[model samples]
Target chain A: MLELFQGPLFISILAAMVRIATPLLFSAMGELVTQRAGIWNISVEGTMLLGAVVAYVIASSTGSPWLALLVAVLACALLSLILSFVTIVLKSEQFIAGLALNLLASGLTLFWFQTYIIGRDPPKFAGFEAVEIPYLSDIPVLGTVLFSQRVLTYVSFLLPLAVWFFLYRTRYGLEVRCVGENPKALDVKGLSVGGRQCLAIMFGSVMSGFGGAFLMLGYSDRFVPDLIAGRGWLVVVAIIAGNWMPFRVVGAIFIFALLEAIGIHAQVVGVSIPHHVFLVLPYVASLVLLAGLRSRTHQPVALGIPYRRE
Target chain B: MAKAFSSLIVGAFGSQKALLGSLAKATPLLLVGLGTVIAFRAKIWNIGQEGQVLAGAMCAYWASLWIGPLPYLIAVAVLVLAGLAGGGVLGLLAGVLKTRFGTSEIISTVMLNYIVIFLLAYLLDGGPWMESGATVAYHQSPPVNAMLEWPTLFGQGAAKLHFGFILALGATALSALLLERTPLGYEIRAFGSNPTALRFRGTDISRLLLVVMLVSGALAGLAGAGELFGTSHRLRAETLLGIGSSGIVVAMVGGLRPSGAMLAALFFGALKSGAIYMRLQSGTPAGLVSAMEGLVLLFFLCAAVATRVHITVRSEAHA
Candidate 1:
């Protein structure tokens, strides 16, 4: 156990935690916006998955990781448009709509992958490579752990702050927040509640797409079915655990990522515990955290409720 | 595309074998769908049916092992009961959390699915329940005693269909009756549509929620037992995990009605059955079937919403 915490091992674990947390951070920040705007977009898992597959397909075919990332975000934006229409325009139940979208994404990705790449050696591209900052990279522990990550990792670290500023510092952000807490007030103010919600949903989905792209282009070499796993759901949990706060949501994501890193490293180090037990550690931790912390966290008043003009 | 579509239709209904195969597939979906409908009717989102099914399967498997020496009919009955208890307990836990801790059933249920799946993996992967044969893989659980297996209801070979299909059909009728003819059924629907009103009338909402969870979980458990005794004969993750989610789609497509769920299950089951044939003959991937299911679910949700809402288009010039 003591050896497990030595200099190199500790730094490696910390680095792994950051990398693992990137996808979660991206999606959680996006979800934080959506939840803040009074919509619980449960389709984050599905949207992230769709983004991952699209990223993989585009990256392998075009050999441009940047273009793949862009396409991923745009494609998911379209997907979230469907969610927005259903939840906002049609006034459907958000949870069920999200579940339907999740299934759709899961099925669509698998079908596309099987139809196009099942038998062949699926094409692979060199994904995003890490960029080193000159002086920062020279710093011993922090350099290797934080400064030498992929460009996306650096963006992920800064995204929560950007979201924080956007939510707290902007007039539109205030309106969006109000749309969730009391859409009636916004409606009475002659503002379009549905329009604000639509933007929030789209923004959240674009972020989810970025997270999915990072998972494929920045983390893995190839795409697989169910590649996004449950990271999208973890993002939801983080939002709940963080009480819809940007910085605390990032903290929750880091804790989850830490558990995930431990799970991976435990297998690498041949820990005596059952591998499945370790695999489930993050989910168990999330449940425990949510159970304990949710009571203290105040969800938006209109979250999951469809707004009406009446 | 036309040829493939024709082949799918013919493959799903061309022969008795194909028909029975579809029925076999539909059995689990129907059972789980019934469970979902019951819970959804009460406005309870018990999305952890996947885990509850696994819990039931694991318990049924254990019960079969211990009761192997008993009379064949008695052993099967005991195994089914064990399955019900196993799944019901997990559902009850979620109910307790919701009533006591104010946890969202959706999140709690999803988390429970992961936890139960991991527990199943742990038990199967070189754990005590793993098959002991030299050639057997870690994932394979030991087959239940022969006496615990359900008797076949059709042609003897690969086309054989088990009696569990009858139980599924029976459950659909039973659930329909429970929802329409009983006071409890009335209360369930009332709770779904207006819980605050029910509370005003002095209804025990928490107790009602617990009962709904128990019944829903028991039906899902029955599905697990049916799969174990009728088809797989051994508990495995691949055989169980997707059933719960598919059941959710089935229930929604059925509009949360027992009779509707039964019909939807049969349709989806035919799609699943035909997808296998399509894969073998046309080289279309089996994943297409799942995609189709999702597409059907999305269409149904849209249709449901369209019926409930009145839409109007206005020019932006009005602003």
Candidate 2:
């Protein structure tokens, strides 16, 4: 246990924790914005999968990580638009459609991967580079803990603040909240509720896609099947656990990441505890957190239900 | 439906070997779909059926691997019980979360599915169940004793049709009876169709939930056994992982009725078996069945919602 806390090991775990938390951060932020606009885009997982696979394919082909990231975000945004067309325009169920989209993404990606992208073993390309802060790099523990990280990780850390500012300080953000709370009232006021939801979902899709990109290029540096690995679902839990607040959501993501780190660390150090028992910690914690949050008063009034003008 | 049948028949039974393979592939989906039907009738959104099936397979395989020299009948019973226990426990966990804390079972069960997959991966790679020896390549748990393997009722060689297919049929029959002819069946139907009635009658929602979830999980656990004792005879990483998704498609298509689930399961099972044949015959890419499953689900949900919307529109126009 003490050996696990050595400088390099501790730093590596912290880095891994940050890496894991980045995608959750991006996804939760996207989900928060979507809910604020009255659309529950539960297809975050699907969008992330699309992003990861597309990004990996592009990166492998062109050897340009930035271009790969661009394609990933754009492709997933298009997928999100398709989802919005079905749910927002056709009045489909959000949860059911979201689940279908996830299945479609998983199936299509795997089919292509098997058919086309076989020989590359680890799905290789140049991964994201760490961005080291100039002055902060020498600051004892804080330097290793925070300043030395990937560019995506830094963006992930700053995203909650940006999202918080957008939601709380912008007129459009207020409009989104109004639409979520009472789409009928928004329609009465001649505001396009459907339009706002469409925009929100697209925005959420891009962020989720970026989150997927982070998984491939920033952390794992390789694309395995289902590589997003329930991080999207974990982000959904973080959204609830944080009571839908941006900062609180980050805290929730961190808690889960810390639990994951502990589990991984416990195994790495060859601890005597049954590793599977430790593996169950994050899920059980999610269950407990979800249970404890039953009384929270911040749920969107019209979440998961379709809306149309009367 | 007829067009689908004609295509399905041509695709599945077009050749002698094709007929056998389809039956082999359909067994797991049939078991999973039957389990899904029970839970859906109780209005329990059990998305963990896949995970439950995985857990069931693991436990059944574990039992077979460890409990040696036991009588064959006792071993089989223990294997089935192990699956039931595994699935029931997971379902009961979902139930507790639902009743005691008001957590959404749909989300919880879905999350549990991922957790189980990860747990299985870990188990196969360096965990307790890991096969001893070289660590460079993938390692797996030891296969079950050959004596413990389920017998094929028909066909030889590649056309093996095991007893699990019969088990699936018996499960569907038993589920139909339990759901249509008992007091508990009435309660399940009542709860799903209208939960307000159960609340009004002072029936403990928590207790009802426990029973429903246990039954749901147990049946799914049997699906795991079907894969293990019936086919693979060993627990592997991907075993029974996606059956939950297929089960959901089946349940939705069947409208949550037991008889409907049986038909839907057969439909899906045939689709899957046919899809494999489709891959072999047409050189169609694999994972097409997955997309087709999604398409079927999308069509079903759209149909349900459209009908509901039409009714609302008509009623509102009348008002």
Candidate 3:
């Protein structure tokens, strides 16, 4: 355990944490916009998996990671329409609608994987490599941990800031927030409630898709059905534990990523605890965090409720 | 696609063996679906059926290890009770989280699912329950004692149906009664419709949540235990993992009604059992069944919304 904190190992751990946090940051930033718009879209997990599956297929077939990323996010964006339709047009239970999307996404992924990937030679694909910043890469531990990463990691780092500026500084952001805080107000202002929500859903879903794509092209070279695991759920938890705030959600995601990074390192570090303990750390932490953090203060007033016009 | 569809239909209902296999597969689904019905009706999203199912099987397996040579029926009963206790405790924890800590059941249940799955992996991989005598340890437990395996109702080999079918039928009837004819059922429906009114009536909503979760988890637990003792007869995560999600699909497509769940279970069970035959007949992957479950669920969701709209329009026209 003490050896884990030794200089170089500690820096490596921090680097791993940054890498793991990249995908989650993408998802959290996206989900925050959706939540702020009062749409509690819980289909992030399924959507992310769909993104990954699409990325895998496209990268394998077309031999272009960029094309895979573009196609995957676009597919996820289109898929969000089903959720928007059910929650917005149909006025069904938003949670159930999300649940349906989740099942649909995972189930479809399983089918496609089984039909194509199984009983065949694994497809080979080249994922993104680390792009080192010229001067910044030389700066001791911080450089390796922050500056030397896949190009997307930097975008994810700036994402929270960009989102913060949008939500707190821009008119459209204020209007989107209005849709969540009070949809009737936006509706009364002659702004379409469903229209704003639909846009927000697509944006959130596209970012989530990007997260999935990054998880694939940034690190993993192979496609598995359960590849997304519960990271998408972790993002959702991060949003809640962070109290729907942009930076706070990033903080929560980093905590989860840090735990995951530690879990990845624990066995190599000769930690005495069962590796399963590390595997479950994020989920356990989430439950504990939510149990301790009882405030729903920042939650959108109309989150998960279907809006109606009389 | 059409060939696959025809094969799926024939494989599901073509013969006595096929029909029995369908029922056998449907048993756990029916039990889990019935359990899902209870919680969903009250509008509490207990999404941890997967974990609850595993917990039930683990608990039952643990009990089986301790039980000495006893009357067969008594031993089986003990295991079943143990299964119920395992899943019920997990459900109760979620309920407590929702009521006491203000944690959402959805999040807590999802967390619990991961926790339970990791725990099972630990158990099966290396911790005590791992099967012995192989150079490489397979992630499964040694089969339960042969005497303790649930008795077959009919058929043999792959299509061997067990006592769980009877239990599932009884459960369907009980769920129908509980949701329609009883005061608790009335409260459940009322709570779903307007919890504020129920709270004003001085009802202990927390207790109700706890009860709903307990019953729901217990039913899911029974499904797991039955799957272990009746069908698989060995605890393997793969055998039990998808039943929970399929159960949810059943409950949802059944329109959250017990009888509807039964029909949906049988339908899905047939689809699953047929998938195996479909795999043999036309080289279709069994994973297609999982996709079809999701497809059916999404289609049902759209249809449900459409019908509700249709009914409202009709009522307005009548007025």
Candidate 4:
């Protein structure tokens, strides 16, 4: 075990962990903002799927990763806008509508990916590259693990801080939180609840889309149907685990990534646990974390309820 | 009534084999859908129906492999039992977590799905569940004993329709009985509508969630058995992909009604089976009908949302 923690493999695992955490960070930030505006936005997975497909298509077609990423973010924003239209403006059951959107995203992406690519996996272009600062890459163990990765990895780290600033330190942020906590009070204050929620959904979509783009561009480098693979839901879990705070969300992502990393390591090393025990690790961990946090944390009073002005 | 009748006639018996194929495919979805309805009614979101289905299929396949020379009736019973146990245990774990830890059923069930997929993948790839020395690029276990399979209703040469259809119908009836005729069902409905109220009344929402999840999972598990015994007769990794999400669709479309689930499941089964047939017939790209499936869901969501909007407006007007 000491040997396992002492060297390059440790650095590799840390780097991989950050990469894994990037999507969750994007999604958690998105979810936090949405919740802050009083919407659950369960369509995070569907939006991310759409973003991945659109990003992969754009990048593969134009061979411009940056342009591809922009398009993906826009696609997710559009998806959020639609969700906002139905749930916020139309006053729908956010949960059911979100689930339907997710199903639609999955079906549509699978259909197109299957159609265009036939049987082969979707094509990939050069994805976003990692940046090395002049002196940062030379630091010892921490340097290799933390400083070395794709741009999205660093962006993921920066995003939480950005989210924290926007959420707690800004006027718009305060308004959003107020709206979430008590929409009627905010309505009395003359803030448009629907407008704020729609904005939050858009903000969340940007992060989710970035996360989706990262899945194809940064992690796997090719789009597969069902590419997000429950990461969207995991992001929601991270939001709750982090107590809806941006920085704390990283810890939740770390716990999940760590569980997954350990499971992969065990399998790679051929450790003889009953295969089912190892298979169920992350889910068990998530359940435990969720249970532990349930009592201690305070969720927004209006988290999943749709808001309409009387 | 007349419109529904026309659609039903066209949908069910537009052709000879169409009705049979539709029913055959509907069996698994109907079972899974009814189970989902049970959980949904209890406010326990058990989305791992596909995993339960796969687990049931694997258990049944495994049972048939080992329980050789047993009477056909006994073998079939063991297969169904094994499926129920495997799925029930998985559901029980989810239920416990939801009850004890306050974890969201949605997240737990989704993650459990991945675990099931990768676990099955591992089994077929090289682990204990693999059939040995397979030449096919894909990994799958051997077919179950032919004698253990369900018999066809119409004729020997009829397409793959079998007793699983009847089993699914029976499950639907049981689901209705469970929800409507029993005190337990009353508690499930009450708990689902208001868990906090149930807690105040000392009804134990956690226990209810757990029981409902287990029962739901067991039903989904039996669906897997039906799929195996009725048609494919083998457990393949290919079956798990879309079935779970489709169950959600069925549950929603049914308005969480047990009989409605049976109907919705039949519709989806036909959609799926017919989509393939239409694809093969039309030479429309294989993905076209899938795209239609996605489009239909999207429209369905829009309609639901629109309805909500109308209700809110009406209530506001009255208020």
**DockQ, every prediction:** 0.63, 0.51, 0.79, 0.46
| 10 residues in a row with least lDDT, candidate 2 chain B | B1-10
Best by TM-score: 3
Recovered native contacts, candidate 1: 0.60
Error of 2 at B71 (Å): 5.7
| Regions more than 4 Å wrong, model 3 | none
Predicted candidate 4 versus true structure: per-residue lDDT over B31-128, tens digit per residue: 88888899888777788887888877777777777886887777778888988877787788778877677777777777777777778877776767
Comparing 3 and 4 by TM-score, which wins?
3
Residue B214 alpha-carbon offset, candidate 4, angstroms: 2.0
Q: Against the hidden reference, what TM-scores do the models get?
A: 0.96, 0.90, 0.99, 0.91
What TM-score does prediction 4 earn?
0.91
Q: What is the lDDT of candidate 4?
A: 0.77
Interface RMSD of each: 1.4, 2.3, 1.0, 3.0
Q: For each candidate, what is the lDDT?
A: 0.87, 0.80, 0.91, 0.77
DockQ winner, 1 or 4: 1
Q: What lDDT score is found at residue A114 in candidate 3?
A: 82
On TM-score, who's better, 1 or 2?
Answer: 1
Residue B311's lDDT within candidate 2 is 97
